[model samples]
Target: MQITKCLHTALLVADLARAEHFYGTVLDLPKAERPLNFLGAWYQVEDYQIHLIVAESVPADLVNSEKLGRNRHLAFSVTDLAAAKDQLLVHGCSIQMSASGRPALFTQDPDGNVIELGETQLA
Candidate 1:
């Protein structure tokens, strides 16, 4: 069987309100109408969607602690890397520039979910 495309990525969040603020308010992702009768929120990014599922606890385990971008992350393309970094900082989000000298930066959500932003286009 051949794969077509990725429909969405579900992330477990401990606090729904904080997650919604980060993804919705901070990141400015459009909220998508979800029909599931559960505690969660959905954000639409281009053709893809991010599903935030509420959980009792979300582990902040990172395989590579030195580099946050090396861990599990959701990457997105931005028009300006500098402006993106500035916005994240203004919202009190800690960010890490790509160690590989790429035009990208990595940050974490309230639940410690890694998010990568770059000026380059994503395939």
Candidate 2:
């Protein structure tokens, strides 16, 4: 089977409130309505979505970038890289710049899930 698009990615989180605050307040992603009996919440990530599900344990390998060069991070394209970087820092989020000469930076969520922010427009 061929995949046309990514509808969503499920991220297991330990704290729902903190994860919600990070995606909603810090990253400015709008919350999506999830059905009743669903054990998770959804957030609009640019054109796609991210699902935050409560989990008692997460694979440490998925959250560890030092071992794999951050190959498993979700990336977003923003209009302004500097502004996004500043906003993340204001929220007490540390950023790691991408060394490929592109306008990109990496940060983590409360659950240690890696997020990459890239500049959408060229200077």
Backbone clash count, each prediction separately: 0, 0
In model 1, what is the error at residue 30, expressed in angstroms?
0.4
Backbone clash pairs for candidate 2 read none
TM-score for each predicted model, relative to the true structure: 0.95, 0.87
lDDT of 2 by residue, 43-81 (tens): 986568899999987665564565323568888889999
Off by over 4 Å in 1: 121-123
User: Which candidate achieves the best lDDT against the true structure?
Assistant: 1
| Residue 40, model 1, lDDT | 95
Q: Write one digit per residue (lDDT tens) for candidate 1, span 5-88.
A: 999999999999999999998999999999999999999988899999999989988899679988999999998899899999
Cα RMSD for predicted model 1: 1.8
Error of 1 at 1 (Å): 0.8
Candidate with the greatest TM-score versus the true structure: 1
